[model samples]
Target: MAKEIVCRDAGYDCDFMIRSENEEELIEVVQQHAQETHDTEMSQEDIRGAWKTV
Candidate 1:
């Protein structure tokens, strides 16, 4: 089974949900979540590599 991580940041009411088939994917999701939802600066390659599964 895979794990899904739900993240929410200050100043935002909507919660960003991400599902990963593995740990690697979760990492990517976290980065994307931070960048897109949280407004944190992140790189595409870093996010891509963070994926654990397709």
Candidate 2:
């Protein structure tokens, strides 16, 4: 199944979502979006544990 994560679920005021064939790629884009738009840096582990990103 493809993985999807929503930025708003992380407590950010923006609504950014990414759906990828693999979790690794999804995490990378999510991290990039966070850094570029939110000015926040997060690791893959952090993203996984932060929410029920399914």
Candidate 3:
């Protein structure tokens, strides 16, 4: 099944969503997005916890 992570779901005011069939890829994308766009860096575990499973 495909899974997605929404920035808003992670308590961000932005509406960015990351999707991937792979969990690691999803985390990588979300981590990068959080850093580049939000100026926030997150660990893999934190990233995993922040995203809503969809």
State the weakest 10-residue window (summed lDDT) of model 1: 3-12
Ordering by lDDT: 3, 2, 1
RMSD to the hidden true structure, all candidates: 6.3, 1.7, 1.5
Query: So what's the TM-score on candidate 3?
Result: 0.78
Q: How far is candidate 1 from the true structure (C-alpha RMSD, Å)?
A: 6.3
lDDT of each: 0.59, 0.77, 0.81
Q: Which residue pairs in candidate 2 collide?
A: none
* Candidate 2: residue 1 lDDT (0-100): 62
Decide which is better by lDDT, 2 or 3.
Answer: 3
Could you give candidate 2's per-residue lDDT for residues 1-54 as a string of tens digits? Answer: 667777787777887887677777778888898899988899988877764434
Residue pairs with backbone overlap in model 3: none
lDDT of 3 by residue, 1-54 (tens): 667788887778998987778988888888888899999988988876665555
Ten-residue region with minimum lDDT total, candidate 2: 45-54
Whole-structure CA lDDT of model 3: 0.81
Which candidate number would show the highest lDDT if scored against the true structure?
3
